[model samples]
Target: MTSNGSIATTLAPTRETLSSSQLLSSSISSLNSSSTRQASSQISKIYRQASTLFLTRRLPESLSTILPVITSPAADDTNPDASPEPAPISRASRTTRIKVWSLYLTILNAIVELDPDEGKQAFGSKEWKGLVNKVRDGDVWEEVVKNGYGGVEGDVDSDVVINLATLLLAHARTQKVNQTRLESYLAASTNPSLDVSSRLSTPTATRPHSRSLSPVKGSGTDTPRDLNARVKILELYTLHVLLRNNEWDYAREFISISSVLDEERREAFLQALQSLQEEQMESERREKEERRYQEEQLKRDVEEARRRRIESEEREKREEEARNRRSEKGSEIDYGVEDSPPRPGSSKSRSSVKGGSVKGGRSLPSSSPTARSSVPAKNVKVPPSLLTRAGNVVMNVRKLVESMAGSFKTRPMLLMQMLGFIVGILVLLSRRDVKERVKSILGKGWGKVRQTAGMGVKVSYI
Candidate 1:
């Protein structure tokens, strides 16, 4: 009743492809076919001699052999005789399935060696790092395999084992191979059913031979237990495949099954594969998108930080310039008395006022007209020598600044201001009284020195 669905039949090789012939025939065919007549005969003789080494005689009466028998169906169609007994059987004489046993032993070792927390250990190494890597990359496996333990490199032996095991498991999974029910299949076939009681059973034809309705055997066809076995075998053999394969072409080899199945089963297996493929694609896409998003966000953050940093630097520069501008304006009215000389006859002693009253830390002269002769001092006035000297200094500074401007073309605004200052200095230099005041200041610089308000900053000619 159980039939293996598409998953089982889709990839498993058939009997003809896997080669159901005897070992002798298979061996001969596999050998080099370019031999001369004499060598070919010699090879044939050797094969014939070797094949006879195994003991195989006719099976006895009372026990039927599993293989097909070549006997004719009936001695006569008119009358029936008691059916001849099948081959005899010896209770103690049972043939062991040697391949299955060996397979089981291998499976046992693989399972026992497998670690949940770690992978399988390579041939000699304690660490399963080789197992973590691919099969061909395992050094221990290579050395041991070269020493003659593992199968030949580039062979499909591992793939065959796993595929076969998986097929067996698929059979156990009770997957159906066909869509039609047993009765419907029977009806469709050429075999005509007769009443059991009226007609005697024929020994040769116990079972009907109908290709259309052949019963699907779960043993080698469809069973979940078979699938479990196959999965284990696949996992185990993957190690071998990794170790031996130079190319993975063989791993991809699978059957294109022509066997028809029920619509429900076909739809189900296709759906499962579809879902698995979809999930894998989705995961990869998500990872790619996440990486791209992170990169873009990082770029945006960096750009924003740079923009902020530039703005802050500009603000700081502007503030520094403003403070410098205020300081420059303050320089117009000298804070340090020594930095700018006083007008003639206006002040003398800078500290204690020698023989004159101290006013605002300056000493006045005893001969000053403003202090004594106030009866008719209309013509009395201050000298302009000091003022003249200060005006000359300003003129010299303007020349020096214009000469400095020759070395730079930037800061045009600052250049214009310098030009304006030059004009102001020129006007001051044109006044006749200012010139006299400057001359007097140069002759009698104050009677005595006054207190120093601040350190003097000289604008030297150099």
Candidate 2:
């Protein structure tokens, strides 16, 4: 006693409350009419009843009632018109067949959750192929496609493949079926003519869902949004399946050629991909920077270690030199003892001298060479002190200046000033005659400065 049964009883009281099985039987019984129109009308009625059953969750009964009408097989397990000849079916029958195919596929998609393998088998059965082939047999196929049957039109072959692929992809994604079936669907959907070489070559801003393109004429139409919804769903499912299979290139190509996706969706997809790329680049950049920093730090550490080693060697050399000097001084002090006979009255003095020398030897500085020489030399050179080297450097500079001053032409302005200073010193040391000549030159320079100033041109003597 479902709602449909209640509704059936209310519509026709001659029938008591019908069970699901009874309702299914009643729908199928009236479909055997001789008139084509009557048969099609009965199918339409059965389609509505099946839809109701589906809503009420009586999927098994709904499928059982719908499949026979759609398949129309003479036998239970085989298609009678496996190789359908050129049979002239009426326009109404053709349309009804198309509707039945659509409903069948829809019901199959819905019931996939119940029995995925059975749904797959049903889609692959000869009954399904026979229906599709029969639809394409005559001009009726073209007319039905052009007029659009059950919301599918234009690009019918590709759309059919996409829809089947979408269904299989859903089953695989939900783990209801093996994922390998998606590969077959993907292969069927891919057409060479639709392949894209670059993503940028594809349109970014897709047309809104309100418009539809007729594949045959490339004309606009106010078609229902169902086709667009299916196309987009297929694209998304195909993309997910391709990614899950690790078909990265195929996924990119699919998105590039996807005409059903809206602009915001495309942007979101590209943005997610772009963000992934950015994350990888950022990780690489950080790794490179870390490596570089480590290298620089190692170099600095090596240099610091080298500098410390050099300083340590210099300190050891200085210590060794001090020890050698102390040892030499001690030897000199020991050798300074006189070789004279001991005086009989000064025996105490001789003994005292011997004892003082022994005490001195024992009390020698620790830096003495005889104390220790086991320390190794580091073969380091000590530079001469600046104070000790300054006189030689000064003498060399004086020689260079003297040589260059032999000719005034080789002397710069600084050398000329020095020469003038020397000349003045020489004149001061000379007699009154050289002093008078210097005084005449200074008076002439002062006279020239005064003459320039009197002429209103400013001048100064250096």
Candidate 3:
């Protein structure tokens, strides 16, 4: 009975498995018919909404809105904890996928182009810097490959590749990495590896629903639109990016050997490259000339300034020397005036005069040697000449008389009294007895003065 139960249990599970497989197959068949139309419609709706947000300058919202449609459940989601991963671009219809990716790239480019403050305000500093760095460092290309192309370089759509190259060109500082990435993609697209063994072993029945839904396009250069896009990519790589990197010869070789470019297009590209090279050379020459002119002008300005400064200093020095010379000359004139001998009739000479009598008086000379020798030689100043001394005295007397006369003009009564006294004196002198008495009195006073002087002289001699 136990063996019978085991067999029944195993048999039941097998039937259930068969039934589940049949249901899965039927569901897949149904999905294949309708999934393409449904996915295209859904992608169109999502793309329109995201494009509207982007046009309205709502970048973060656009990024958020578009993310879900392009991502799928993670491969490890069986654990119920793994996060969703980005969906491969091949999962969407070709046109929708290109539109979605172009919008996404444009949004990223816009975000990178935002003013730092505005970017930081919309997305915090860390997030904004991360986005900008992703674009600038050419990491966005790798991201598109890994997330959108299932890590298949050759599988990247031409339009999407063009967009990626454009984005990197606009923001990236270096083009070497971009150049290498483009070269790899071009090589891979041109020479795709065919894994015959993998294809033979993997039966068409067990293939993923997504693969059946979106078949891979045969070649990039098949359609006219595809050819044009491929040519554009080449133009960007050769004309824009390679020129920036100065890979002139390599660009020429690439254009020459490119399978997509016709002979006419090839000639046009070469002529353009030649023109660009000439323009670059001309621009460089102009820049060098301008730089040299600026340097020379700067040097001339410095020299001019230095010369002016020196001239100013020299002028000041000359002025100072002239001022010093004038001061010295003035000082010498003052000293000369101070040290010069006094003039003949000056007040200093007048004070030096001695032993000069009044105008009508005669003074006796000193006979005693002791009197002559009494004064020290250094203390004795030479008297002015007799005539000059007399002239000065006469002038002084004349001035005094003039001053008296001027005073009399203001007081007539005082002048009259003085005249009357002089008349009285003259009338008294006219009397003989009066004249005799005046003469005797004058003689007596004169004799007494002579006697006193004689006594003094005798005493000194003794």
lDDT: which candidate is best? 3
List pairs with backbone clashes in candidate 3. none
State residue 174's C-alpha deviation in candidate 3, in Å. 1.1
- Residue 176, candidate 3: alpha-carbon lDDT: 87
lDDT of 1 at 213: 18
Q: What is the lDDT of candidate 2?
A: 0.52
**Superposed Cα deviation of residue 25, candidate 3 (Å):** 9.6
Cand. 2 TM to true fold: 0.30
Estimated TM-score for each candidate: 0.28, 0.30, 0.64
For 9-62, candidate 1 gives per-residue lDDT tens digits of: 754666455565566555643342222233334434433332232123211110
What's the lDDT for all of these models?
A: 0.37, 0.52, 0.81
Model 2 weakest lDDT span, ten residues long: 204-213
RMSD values, in order shown: 29.3, 26.2, 25.8
Candidates sorted by TM-score, best first: 3, 2, 1
**What does the lDDT read for residue 54 in candidate 2?**
73
**Residue lDDT tens for model 2, 1-462:** 799998886777554445665887555434422244665677778778887887787656676777656332243346664432211112135445555546655665565454435544655555444443332232223332333322233333334334444554554333222134333333333322233344224232211111222233321112444445444545455445555465556556666666655677666666655565567679889999999999999999999999999999999999999999999998887665333323444544433443332234664333333322222223668888998699889999998877877654665776778889999898685879877888899999999998878776443432
Where does model 3 exceed 4 Å of error? 1-30, 74-89, 197-219, 338-462
Candidate 1 lDDT (Cα, 0 to 1): 0.37
Please give the clash total of every predicted structure, in order: 48, 0, 0
Write model 3 residue lDDT over 1-462, tens digit each, in one string. Answer: 899999999899999999999999788767753675676788899899999999999998998898776655456745766434546344567677879889989999999999999999998999999999999999889878776666678877888999999998999979987898998988887777567576446443333234322234454788798788888989999999999899999999999988889999999999999999999999999999999999999999999999999999999999999999999999999897555555666544444344433356753334433323332234567889999999999999999999999989998898999999999999999999999999999999999999999999999999
- For candidate 3, report its TM-score: 0.64
